[model samples]
Target: MSVSELEPGDREFERTPPHDIPAEQGVLGGMLLSQDAIAEVIEVLRTADFYRPAHQIIYDAVLDLYGRGDPADAVTIAGELTKRGEIARVGGAPYLHTLISSVPTAANAGYYARIVRERSVLRKLVETGTRIVQMGYNADGADADEILDRAQAEVFAIAEKRSGEDYVPLSEIMPGALDEIEAIGSRGGQMVGVPTGFADLDALTNGLHPGQMIVVAARPAMGKALGLSTLVPTPEGWTTMGALEVGDEVLDADGRPTRVVAATEVMHGRPCHEVEFSDGEIVVADALHQWRTSVAGVTAVRTTEEIAATLDEVHVIDGPDGRVTKIVDVRPVASVPVRCIQVDNTDHLYLVGRSRVPTHNSTLALDFARAASIRHGLTSAFFSLEMGRNEITMRLLSAEARVALHAMRSGTMQDEDWTRLARRMSEVAEAPLFIDDSPNMSMMEIRAKARRLKQQHDLRLVVIDYLQLMTSGKRVESRQVEVSEFSRSLKLLAKELQVPVIALSQLNRGPEQRTDKKPMVSDLRESGSIEQDADMVILLHREDAYEKESPRAGEADLIVAKHRNGPTATVTVAFQGHYSRFVDMAQ
Candidate 1:
């Protein structure tokens, strides 16, 4: 029965679902006639988009040949169908010829494919509505709210399907692929990826490239912290602790203005202490907040907690202001919201409050997301499973602006630090860097979000803070197997999006037993699988971290343990722990 002729009260199941037989035939015929038509139609219409079973078989056969770098013409398609023993089901070679004869021109292939897709969408909607109605009728004791939610999900599934990738002809892909290859060749083997800004690392690896999975594994423990209400001196005037942000300026230990490179959000309800100076001036800070002091004519940086514990001894403030105020008291106080900031000063010291209380900030380690995005201008997505969004932003700010991470975190930024930050603020702010810090995320969820981000922002790189933290969300035999599965999926994701995926990993402490304390590829928690799945493996090692007085105290070795396309070597780069960044030694 015709769909238009059916009445509302009549059984709608008797009528045919929405479809355009002529449009389907036209799409197939055009594709069989021209490679250009195949390229156009392949993107729009999948095998199931055809109304007739025979046309679906023919379409599949055409794609099969085209994907194998063979012609998709009538003869080749018929041969493909015969190989599958489906020639008779598709009405043999004669029906294929009929389809070609039916099409006037292959130029209209896209139009025909669109019509086929529209009909297919309509058919899917009908099927979905039918299922939802059945669910409603059979929902014995089910909540109406639950049914409604399911109905919405059912409707949304159609939208998801519409945006899905389908089987495509290589003919449509080869041109761009070849262009990229030629472009790389034209550079005379120069770096093609987002540069790490480290000359030696970039030289060995040719930069971080697309469709590659780079595993960065290391041993743990590296960070620094600070309090909110302390006053900071900026160029404009003194501002409260919580008021400072990235790119602001404040006075440094040398009494010079330096830019603030990084500033974190106010962390609330943190343990704080009050330090009362002999001069009647006072400053409140977190237990971890450091202060510059002298005891017995010896200068050192001590945390508020450390100083408080030793309040019995005489302590004097020896600051850049040249003030020598003896500490009358250091006592624990109420917990309050606190913020921190980092500066670009070598001393990493800044003044706070009307009395110009001297404060100190500690340094931290780094990452490459900001370098890729802000420095290289490549849009990137960072999935930080371990750290929150604020922490990620703080790291990026510190790295890009060359500010001390501890100063940024401790609300102790200098004015020069602020000036330097202001110079790079625009670049950091405008760079297409996205961060997701959803904790304990499953691989499926990460992949889904990455795909959406890529679709929206054209993501060029993806970074997962550490792979061991990710869950597969599936039942598996062992932890190793689960990790292996995640690594395999990560590799597939890289190839699917055609972008680099850097999955941070943790070493199994095997490096600690070694004399050099250097991490090897075998040190990766799930070494066998990760080393197999990754296109490259980079081990980060700092000798000073293991042996405090090592000769290479400020240098880090980026050991390229496994390079699928090149030679393996150790690239020594300056580890600016204070700035939370790595740089070429020349800097």
Candidate 2:
């Protein structure tokens, strides 16, 4: 029945999220006549982010015509709708013209679009919140951790659906900061991080203060070790680093075979390996303090020549060792990978990274979502666009239990394996995580589901299996546009929920054409908006996939290619494909 046709409260039992019909009409009406207004309206809302079906259809027409670089007025829009046979569907041509006459000006089109978006968000929140309340009520009968995660996820989902945060005045913020300081003082503490446990550390920093992040990082070896087992290739033959002792032969960076005359002590806290090449330059390799951070925690850096590359190669003859090479070791450059995780005052959005098939990107996504729920005690929701629910469960079980994926799949688990799996089963059963392996799902469905989940669970994080697979609300002319719209919607979803959305992405073979074969931001398959809309992009590069002759045979690179809020760098990780898991590359 038409809502307007009914008397007030005729269907009092019928309930829905809030909406304004005239507002929707006014927005469409404003854009239907003005070509200039279409640009402004499109920025604020997508056709599906709207509440009503007819409004969505009308907005889609406006966007489609605008995209084609055609003029969009009421008459042209009606003609286009008629051509597509949607004229009667959206109340026909009369309704189209009726919208134009309804709006006083096209200038408020953006404002009207915002109103539609706001209503849509509000409605989703109401729907999601009710579901969360029901979940809470069922908590006594349900698994608490799972229910809590779902409930938290649902609430957070609603929070994320809203955009922007109100700025609190310093007066409002400083009192809390000062209160923290006062509490520390009352506890006989001098300052926040002002004095560390160690006296030496306290002297160095005076005190670890507030509003700063301290990272205690594990080191990754680079430079001095890329030539591991040093059967390093030369024109003569493959020679080991140890075999080529003092006065032994080895190849230089330029492929020159030269004798190593002298190995000298260089310096600490610097790339200090100084190996002399007879009648040539000395190779000074500063091998100290080499480390790189990755998405999967920490792992070894790629090359021993990292810091040594900064040095100038020079030939310097000294003593009776004849003409020899000397390496001028240079200090290395440092990178700031991620920022401090501020409890309440900060926010982060991330693109977990990219991968080729079988690189275990999905496994990494699972680990990331699990970490949010388990380690940080935050609720997480995962949307698996590819794998089914049971398969994902097995993988999760394998990862959580540290059991081989093959064992879990084959049901040939040993005694300890079963014990471990049993112990973890309870933990896994209780973890506040929600997973959905719905196939061919649309973005609108994801939003509604996520909002519902958030309302019930207070979900702090959301993960979409992959971007390209997400169904768009409407058929787009170009595949790029379709994916672009999805990417934009995902961004809005993250912002609306006020949580990180780790959406896995598949990379193009562009990485395969290069020697390094590292996925770049450009390698993101179809849409340019994938990069544009994302706050951060982490690219996964597995060297073993690229080369049979690499020490990185067991490793993958977590390349932070685009970080809108922080630094970008590459770190290493170990992908245990059989377990469907990833871990910090162990030393």
lDDT for every model? 0.72, 0.58
Mark the regions of model 2 whose C-alpha exceeds 4 Å error after superposition: 1-359
- TM-score per candidate, in order? 0.58, 0.44
lDDT of 2 at 467: 69
**lDDT tens digits, residue span 73-186, model 1:** 889888888889999998889988999999999999999999999999899899888889899899998766547655764564465455323555697578669988999899
lDDT per residue (tens digit) for residues 89-167 in model 2: 8998888888999989989888888888888777777777778778887677665545655565565644555432346
